[model samples]
Target: MNTLSPTTAAQAPPSRWALASLSLSMLLPSLDTSIANAGLPALAGTFEASFAQVQWIVLAYLLSITTLLVSAGRLGDLMGRRRLLLCGISLFTLASLLCGLAPSLGWLIAARALQGLGAAIMLALTLALVGETVPKARIGSAMGLLGSLSAIGTTLGPALGGVLLVASGWQAIFLVSVPLGLLNSWLAWRYLPADGPFAKGKPRGFDLPGSLVLALTLGAYALAMTQGHWVLLLLAAAGAGLFVWRQGRVAVPLVRLQLLGDRQLSAGLAMSLLVSTVIMSTLVVGPFYLARGLGLDALAVGLVLAAGPAVAALSGVPAGRLVDRWGTRRMTQAGLLGMALGGTLLALLPSASAVPGYLMPMLLLTASYALFQAANNTSIMAGIDPQQRGVVAGLLSLSRNLGLISGAACMGALFAFATAADVSIASAPALAQGLHASFAVATVLIILALLISHFALGKRGQSGTPD
Candidate 1:
């Protein structure tokens, strides 16, 4: 396989076919997140599983994919990005097929894990590909398109899953990816030129031992978050310690800790984590209020919730421009402020309210989020050297996933307390109390993120000029 592209204007611009390949590759993973989300009840009945079991089918995929993407991204650099992308597409397609055919919830969960692995490779390397294929001046546009697609995925996930669930049932949700995955694979093979295998010299091995340590740590962390296992959380700390030690000594560590030393990249990663926490938890909170508390139908709730992601996508181009001018510090600061406003709006929402009250704040939050998501990613990716693209991609993916994990766990605990009071979500005061506490926490997290960006990214961090 060929390695990095020679930095010359090639015979052709990356064709629409090439963009299609990358976009479709991106679309599948984005689809999987929400496609199954709205169909959970149908899936539970089909498999005869409980609510908790159904949740994991999605949660497991999130955790596994997040964990693997960083490693896979680095591997893409070491091996070949095109090769990794193709392999990921194939695996995702195969896993989607398996998910459709799953005999039990257990089987579906396992299948989803494989799908996550495939997504990790594709997501992590997507920008890396853009870095290689697109000219420097056009890279921002390419990344803008990427941000818009990601936002589109977020917006469409619920609606797409709802459609599949209504039309055919839960299995069809998984099956939806088959065509898209195949199309992506075919396009990549056709439009993407072959590249060299990574790192021709030294035979630098992947740090499997460190991977195991990280797996143990993050696995434990995810389990503790999902199951509320405090003991496992303790074990996770120990695992993290060992993983850090291992990475320092290993030549090509699974996670290069030195990358964290880049202040801007570090800030970008932190903000990604905190902001994802706030947004994802809001997703958790909003549906509960709509469905159980207000007694709205699932379809209506899904539609109402779609507003956030929709706003996010719409804001992408403008947000990218802001980042181009003001930099991530200002954009991320604004994003966090919007999040704080969103939480306040939700706190003031009346019981049995229409989508309007919730939507306005969500819209603001989404618009701000567009900048945070894209700008932070650009900051982190731009901070790293070309050689470390995969690794950085992996780290970015990891930070976001872990942040979501943290958010989910924290919110789960909060909700549990509120629910224990026998105050249904329909009780405006009760719901507000819970959301207020959680959102306050999220606000603080965002503030800390802003501080990190202010101090770590701008003048102090020598990653590079923002891409």
Candidate 2:
């Protein structure tokens, strides 16, 4: 795999500009994730549909994005990242408009799914585009910016989406992106250069069958993880193993499993899943504890929960610098250790816990979340190459999203299992038990990730380059 020579310090392509555009592209999907959770009731009222029917609008978006993200990223490389960006932006904008004007639940759901397709393409490919346009050395900075933007979008999305819903109704939420999308598309075409000369990976185009296998395998896995049916989990594992096998046989696969030949890359992916699961699970548990156990209002819980990610976005830049200087191993270790400590502390807190005690741990947890995310993003992007960026980005996105989803599912399962075992959660005590269990599970995942990272970084003697 070929990489471009490092660009001189004077010629940075103003990574900040590329950062802004890519960030804009990324903001849409992350924002869309919970952007409509609140709007569901309103949408049901408007379309005169049942609550369950309206819920499909949100679910459709998740299902579509998760299923198609890998394919979308590969397609970006096979065609052109910029071309796909423009197309996706166009489709996304149109879908947003349609969603705003949706006269019925079905139309809104369909439109939202269309929006998901665009978002999936944009999400996976934007990282790839960053690799192509930005120099390799500053790639860490680019990744940090991307990581910050993702956190910012999530942190700001609920309020932003809520405001849009209130100010101009649901139409405003979707309409806001249309102009941004158009403007972003025009700017990308003008500025983002084609960098095929320094492309990486096997160099052949994508394999459609390989992509479908991934979709089936990963898609099934996501379903199983979400629903937590044992049968589905087994099927997902089988499908994933076969998908990997199939990729090995194909000269130019959608996902190049050979990338994993390096220990660090594998470790990085594992660390991402583990840390993400811990953070995400705690987040889910925190809300439930506040809402049900402690008897707080939804609004209060949201505002309180928002504090963590907000701090995370603010801390991203510093974390990136640390990643560049300290190397990923130290940062990864520190971040995970901090996360485990914070989560464990939260779980161990007494039922009558006060704000003062919670505040410190919350901030620490937020910092860990920020540090781990920025460091991992840097390591993963730097770990692979320009062409394989698509598949690598896809896997990173897949695992990260999957971890968050799985965290929530695991919490529920823990509650069910504990309940069956007759664990009394008087203050909706099962919530804490579930969270504790999730944290413990996350700790195991991170420990495994740490071992993988050690090997991935190579033995004491070898250069830490990709295998």
Candidate 3:
């Protein structure tokens, strides 16, 4: 596939209708990621599965998407963002239907993996297309809106899932996506632009070997985390080494290794990974603390938990304007500092309190994340050439996915290990102790992210170059 040069004339800004379609398309996958968590208990009861087995329902989807993101992005660059998005929406819709109809846990998990593949495709292209379609001056605002909607979808998942579960069943959560996906696909087909020319004359065929090795690397890492198998770590390392070696040698690499050399882009990616780890860890553990330690019901927990993302959604557009005016570095620094404070608050708060203690910290953390996401995303996308946006978008998505998987696995492990005596029973006190430890760790991670952003992202008040 050929692509237009980076300096080519800017395309017309996407109309509100097109942007709405894209935003809705993005929301589906984001919502799907967390919605199932609200119904995990119901699902476990239905299948008579162990806690570990039921976890795969979420893990399978995350792992599949995490493994395939970079490859999917490259595919979008080669094929066409609009075309790939259409296919993704179709597949995701079908998979959601299958998940809703699945008669067994195994079947639902399998369908979820398919859903992940579709999500990877859609996510990889959404940002690239948005960047390409919108004017450079407005990219920050567009990214902010997109990021805001995605966060809203994720934050709303549990609450929405609760309503569906109460009204119909767990199946309703999956079934809900089917109609949304269809509508999104139709809007995309009607409004989205066609693919651009490739950089080369002939298509550089997909780098199958590199993609396989990359997938193996991530799969091994995730398996090791979930299964507590040390050998898989070595396999993952080997695959990473091979993947890096292949990218340097291959004509059409899955990712261009040189992209990592860009300080801004690299820093943005690193920050995204760490921030996502903290956010996802909070999302995974916060509800447990609320429901189990504080003894709140699902609805109460959902309301309390929604504070962060709600704050994030509200702040997103404003954050984008700040990024445009004050620059990515300053906004990102402020955001990271806010996250650090939020994490610190969580670590110190008495887990017995559910209202102000829990909700305040979450609001701070999530609002900071909103600022960071909009600024950091604009920075990363701006640092790269337009033609390479697809690949970089995939990389960005890869970082977030891996961070999510790591957060869930690592925090779960830490909680279990810290509460070894009460592992089976999971007494409230023990759970509280584990949550404190997890939050402490997250705080430290955020500080480290802050330092990285400071040193690597350059001086404050430096606006990123627009796409």
Candidate 4:
């Protein structure tokens, strides 16, 4: 297949303004993920719905993104990234407006799903554009900036959503995105480079069958994770089998199976899954520890929790620079080592050490995560074939999302098991024991990630090449 070469520093780096537009695109979707979660109770009250029904407001958005992300990326590859991204932004804005105006629970859920579709496109295309716009030498920095903004958006969501919900009602939570979406669209159109013309031939057709099967599979898997249904897990497994079978026979598969054979790419995806799972443990386990073990109030717990993302936001750009200077391989290992140390500290430190003890490890873990994410992403994108950048970026996002889901389930379960009592009634000592056990498991996971990085990336020097 004929394609334009990937953008490189030699071809002139894109302006900082262009990078800002892409950064905004990254921020919007990450914000939406947690923003609505804060408004779930308000939405339940407004719609007079049960908690289960209201939960769909958040689940719909997540399901839509998880199911459609890869397809959205491939569509961008076929239809043109720039064109599709504008459409995505427009759809997101319109959907956000609809969500704010929704009169019933069903309407809000549908609108959230639509918003998720747009978000999937934006999330996938923004990274793809970096490969198309940023110079290779500076890719880590760009990745870092985008990663920082994403962390900020996610961290800012609950606080921002709570303030908006209290002052303006639940509608404000969804409505806020409208103005940001409009601004993002304008900036993207004005600053983003135009797409080169497609190579002439019979245009490549989308893999409808494969997309449908994969979507169903992912939907089932996500449901299985969230709802803890063995039946859904089985269904997901069956769907996966069907997807693999269909991909092998299809004329144009959504995901080329051969791509998975690349040890570097596979390892990158695996490491992302493991690291994200470990990072998510902080979110899943920390709240209980702060409230129970540390005997903090709700407000204090939130304040303590915010420290992690705050560290992530602060360290993103500097971490990216380190990756650029030290090389992806070295920085990747360094980040993992830092994370392992943090996890070990969290496990070993006594609750008597108090807030500072928790914050210390939490901060280190979050900062190292920013470094690892920027370095790992740069390593993956730097060596990718240009034509596959979109789908690959989508895969990276998907792996992270899956890890979060896994962490929520697995880590939460681990904590409960360690407590050996009903979580709500667990004592401070029990909670502390749970925290220690959870971080011990998290440290193990990080060590495993380190092993993967060491073996797959090899003892290479500055360049991220395996010897």
Candidate 5:
């Protein structure tokens, strides 16, 4: 367990192998998140479960990842990032194996939860590790590349999963990660820098009580969202209060409350939440419309959905350079505006010949995501000190996860309510109406995000401060 002192800086450029390993490690989690959706019907049929029950396969994974992210990040800081990354890759691989061999829906869901835990660890550390490894001058570009890989993984998941499902089975989707995870683990072991040793005289280790409380808070909130249970919401509130109190009292708290005082970082986190919410919402609603409303097959739906992230992936490197030159504020504003425009376009799409309409809006939305993610992440990470990178990175990841869960829940609820009469068997017209309503809601959210960015983010050439 080697550890570098907080004050120490990288003496040379990061190795390309190290960066490649990080990117490869990231792909598993990002791909898993979206890939399960494509195999939902197959999973349901195999397990003799209904659609609602099969949904747990996805929801369980999401809940586990979101709830554990902050804790994993803090632990990485206390323990060792390289160590955690290897462990995560190993655990994810094992979990993927379990998922592929699952005997029942319950077993699959449980395996997915385990997989999510591995993802949480990896997601929490990926950016922080990259920041530590890369030069300050090129942080934006590095983050941009990582963000692009993430976008590609997410976009490619469904398409790849569809092909796998048709060629092999639903189990193949989970099994796919086994070899990739092993390769990533080996690459990480060989390439990643070590954290020399735990700092001397630091509070004896991570704050277990605080971590527990925070996990409870996040878990309860996720359950409330997924189950629509008021009791879980109340528990979440209580857990949050206790967690906050514990943080103020504990030595080396899981998260330093003081970090939230930085306006730029805080705003960046908020914007990340909003942007992710819009992205996830669109991903969910768009597929439903394309598959059900338009009567397209899985392959067509996957292709249609891939366009947005594909555009984002293609433009990511350019967006990163622009952020370095033009600053985060300008790029973020432009991105948000693009998202608003995309959402508006989606809302106006007609029921017939919707593929063209969907493609154009998705392109705009994903491109916006590409631009916003790199710039916003760079701004947030730049504000924090090196010693606090892991926790701050966790917070950043937490914002995105929270946004994703909330977006899925909110949009899912809205769509369900809008089509309540035809909930079980919705007609094309009914599905179209629901999608239109959802897109309109997304448009409103983008506008709200724009206002938040304008008020909370700094102006052009002033990316360092909040307005």
Candidate 6:
């Protein structure tokens, strides 16, 4: 049950195998997300379920991960990260098997929820482990590699799932993870640095109440967003207030309130949320624009949409190297500005220009995203202490998840409102209107993020913080 590596080893050069293990952890969760999405139609047919019912297969997974991420990270800090990660991989593998074998929609959804819990552990600890495995000088590169792999998984998932679903049915989509999970488990156990014997001291106590309240709050929020229910949203707000009050009073809180005072960490989280929200617009709005506005068929639309993630995957490692060379703050600002430019182009470009017009802006946006993610993560994690790494990493992931959730809910609504009609049957002019409006708002969001980054990172610079 080893957790934190010795300080000397933590500062040493990273083993390529260790980095590969971490990268795979990132891939599994992201891959599962897109893969499951692609299989929803098949899943619905298999279980004779309504669309609403089958949606739970995805929602359950998201809800579980969103609710439990922070708690999982804090637990890793208290117990042992490597040990917990292996447990997570094993759990995910078993749950995948369960999902594949499920006899009913309810069973599959439940298994997906269990798998998401494992994914939370994996996602949270992978970033935390980065500091332990990689030398500080190459932190950006490592973060970039992880980011790239995540994008690759996302880019590949739908295509892979479609093939599997056609060849072997919906079950194969979930079943695919079993072997990957097994290999990941072995890699993690064999290559990840081992924990030393538990240090002699009073063992850290877990915050059961805080974890429970936070989970409930996040669950409520996720459901509210997905279901579009005002009552659930209100409950989520109340639960959030209660969680904050609880955290302030507890001695061993799940997350220390004071940690938010770190300008770099706080700003990084905020920027990640903002940037991710903007990114989600592509997924939410792009499909409609391509299909209705540009008159692309389903296959053409899919191919066009895939370009963004593909660009992101290809640019990740290079983006990280740029972050390392130029400095995190500089690279961060550059990425934001680049994204804003892309957003502006999307907003201004006429739909008559068709796929090329759409792709130029999207390519810029996704590539800049890779840069922003790598720089932002390295900026925050490079400065965090070992004991708090897990929780901080979890917070980063949580913020991004929340942003994606928020974007999917809000941006989709915005697009619909702009269209002023049913998107499915909207006229080309109406759909183009929606696309322009969405990207305009997205550009605004990026500008806001840039302002925040400027002020926050400027403060960090003034204080002479080292990254």
Better of 3 and 5 by lDDT: 3
Error of 5 at 73 (Å): 0.4
Give the per-residue lDDT digits (tens) of candidate 5, residues 7-124.
4445323468888888887778999998999999988888889999999999889888888888888888878788988899999999999999999989999999999999999988
List, residue by residue over 322-434, the lDDT tens digit for candidate 6. Answer: 87777888889889999999999998988678899999999999999999998899888888877888899999999999999999999999999999999999999999899
lDDT string for model 4 (320-384, tens) is: 88887888889999999999999999999797899999899889999999999999888887767
Q: TM-score of the candidate numbered 1?
A: 0.89
Can you write out model 3's per-residue Cα lDDT over 1-467, one digit (the tens) per residue? Answer: 11233543344334676687789878999999889998999999999998889999988888888888888888887887788889998999999999999999999999999999999888888887776566567767888898998888887887799899999999998999999999998888877766666657745678999999999999999888767888998999999999999999999787888889988888888989998888888877777778877888978987777777788988988888778877778888888999999989888888556578878888889888888898888888765776677789999988887787778788777767765545446878887787888889999999999999878866734765333
Ranking by lDDT: 6, 4, 3, 5, 1, 2
Clashes of each: 7, 3, 7, 1, 7, 1
- TM-score of candidate 2 on Cα atoms, chains taken together: 0.89
**Residue-level lDDT for 103 in candidate 6:** 92
- Please give, for residues 1-467, the per-residue lDDT of candidate 1 as tens digits: 12244543354346566767877777678778767888888888888889988999888788777667777887887777788899999999999999999998889999999998888888888767766665443444455667788879867887778888888878888898898888889889877766644445734678777877777688899888878899999999999889888888888787778778877777777788888888777777777666666667977887778778887877777776666656655666666777767766666666545567667877877777777776676666655687778878877878877887887778766764755555343464566566656666666777777777777765621222254
Pairs in steric clash, model 6: 2-195
Best by lDDT: 6
My TM-score estimates for the predictions, one after another, are 0.89, 0.89, 0.89, 0.96, 0.88, 0.96
Worst 10 residues of 6 by lDDT: 458-467
Q: How does candidate 5 score on lDDT?
A: 0.82
Is candidate 4 or 5 superior in TM-score?
A: 4
